[model samples]
Target: MLSIGELSKRTGVKIPTIRYYEQMGLIDAPERSSGNQRRYSRQGFERLSFIRHGRELGLTIEDIRELVTLSCHPEKPCGDAHHIAARHLASVQARIAKLKRLEKELKRISILSDSGHVGECNVIRSLSDHSHCETEH
Candidate 1:
């Protein structure tokens, strides 16, 4: 058996986050020691590591929960996991496109401030009035 602190250290997950995962039903509540401290099995360590990896990949908690359920049924097809990854990939791509548009708008506005005075600053003017933007960010 491992202490909660040891589990956190091994998994690179914070102690508070481990508790939150327990509350969220992402990981099972660990057994307590005689002194009331949490004691975790190797299975708990593996589960927490899985949760950490899923979170690092930007998977939503609900998605992670579903994935965990899917993991338990190894005989099932992997289509659901593929679908989840595809959806997340699309979201990431859309955000990247939006960021590119924002970058372009910033570049255009940044070059507009030729005057030393803020009163005559096109950058400030462009920001105050969205109409000056060539593209929607």
Candidate 2:
């Protein structure tokens, strides 16, 4: 068995985070001693390690919860995890596309403003013109 501090050291997660995981019911709270100090079993140690690994992979709390539940039933299909990963990938690709569009717009403005006076600055002109918005009129 290990205390919370020891668990933190073993898992590389902060003490407060372990408490937070307990509060979220993602991990079970360990038994307490006469001093109200937690003592964890090997299972708890492994669970903490799993949670830290999930967090490192950028899993959301809900995703982690789902992963944990799925892990509990080892024989069950994990297609949902794959679905979640696909959604995250799509979101990342969409952001990359938007950033590329913004880069093009910035380059266009740069070309339009080169050596222009402040009053004639195309950068300012483009920003002030709502008609230039890629998202709207």
Candidate 3:
């Protein structure tokens, strides 16, 4: 068994975040020592590791919950996990596409702008006049 500090250190998750995960039901509540301090098992360590990796991958809390639930049933099909991953991939791709458009727009604006007074700034005029942009911001 490990203390809360030990678990936090091992998992690289903060103490409050560990408590928040417990509150969110992402992790099971740990057993308490006679002093009423939380004592975690190796199982907690593994679960927290899983949660940290999921968060790093930008998985939603609910998505992580579903994955955790699915993990508990070894006999269950992994189609749900695959679906979650696909959905996330699609979202990421959409954001990438949007960012590319923004990049093009910024480049266009920068190229159009000449070093002039702010009163006659091409950048300001282009920003005010949406017709200057071909992309839908």
Candidate 4:
């Protein structure tokens, strides 16, 4: 058995995060010693490692919980995991599309401002005019 600090060190997870995981029911509660100090088994380390990897992959807390549940049922197909990844990919794609539009708008503004003063700047005029942006649509 290991102390909470030792478990944190072993898994590269912060102590408070581990406690939060416990509160969230991501990791099972550890056994308490006579002094009420948390004592963790090797399985705790493995569980924490899984949680850390899921977090690094940008999985939401709820998604991570579902993935952990899926991990326990290894006999089942991984379609659910694939679905989660696809959803995340779709979100990233949407953000990229929005960013590309913003980039185009900024480029248009910058090109129009080349050696131009603010008083007669097309960039400022565009900024003041919401009708000029495709994004406002």
Candidate 5:
């Protein structure tokens, strides 16, 4: 068995985060030593490693919870997991599109600005008047 700190070190997750995960029911509450400190088994380490990897991949807590639940039943298909990933991918694509629009706006602003005084600056005027933008992001 490993102490909570040791588990944190091995999993590269903070002690507080581990506790939070427990509170969120992502991880099972560990056994306690006689001193009342948490002790984790090797299985706990493996479980935490799975959660940490899921989080690093930007999976939402709910998604991770579902994944954990699914992991308990090996007979189930992975379509749910694939659906979660596809949803995240769609969201990421939307954000990328929005960012590309913003980039174009910035480029337009740069072109509009001729280093004129602030009073006559086209960039400032464009910012003040959103109508100057042809596309709605």
Candidate 6:
């Protein structure tokens, strides 16, 4: 058995986050020691590790919950997991595209000369008028 602190150290998950996961039903509540301190089983360690990896991959809590449920039935097909990953990938791709557009607009705005006076500054004029932007950000 491992104490909560030990579990956190081994899993690289913060203590509060581990508690939050327990509250969210993502991980089981660990057993307590005789002195009332939390003691986690090996299963708890593995489950927390799984959650950490899923979060690192940008998987939503709901997605991870669904995956955990799917994992319980080892005989079932893995198509649902694949579908969830595909949806998240599409979302990431869309965000990347929007970021690229924003980057382009910022680059265009940054190159304008300020002319040493706000009244005659191309940068200020461009900012005041959205029509000057080359792309919708």
Best by TM-score: 1
| lDDT digits (tens) for residues 35-106 of candidate 5 | 999999999999999999988878889999999999999899999989988998898898899899888877
Ranking by lDDT: 3, 5, 4, 1, 6, 2
Clashing pairs in 4: none
The residue-by-residue lDDT of candidate 4 on 1-137, one tens digit each, is 98999998988999999999999999999999999999999899889998998888777899999989998999989999999989988987888998998898888777863786888897788789887566545
Better of 3 and 5 by TM-score: 3
lDDT of each residue in 81-112, candidate 1, tens digit only: 99998999998898899899888878877875
Positional deviation of residue 33's Cα in model 5 after best superposition, in angstroms: 1.1
Q: On a 0 to 100 scale, what is the lDDT of residue 34 in model 2?
A: 91
The TM-score values for the models, in the order shown, are 0.81, 0.67, 0.81, 0.71, 0.77, 0.80
lDDT of 3 by residue, 27-132 (tens): 9998999999999998999999999999998899999999999999979999999999999989889889989988887787688536678898766776798785
Measured over all alpha carbons after superposition, the RMSD of each candidate to the real structure, in angstroms, is 2.7, 4.2, 2.7, 3.7, 3.1, 2.9
**C-alpha positional error of residue 13 in candidate 4 after TM-score superposition, expressed in Å:** 2.2
Model 2 is weakest, by summed lDDT over 10 consecutive residues, at: 108-117
Candidate 2 overall lDDT versus native: 0.87
Candidate 1, residue 67: Cα displacement in angstroms equals 0.1
Name the weakest run of 10 consecutive residues (lDDT summed) in model 3: 106-115
Q: Clash number for every model?
A: 0, 0, 0, 0, 0, 0
Kindly report which residue stretches of model 6 are placed more than 4 angstroms away from their true locations once superposed.
111-128, 132-137
CA-lDDT, candidates in order: 0.88, 0.87, 0.90, 0.89, 0.90, 0.88
In model 1, the clashing pairs are none
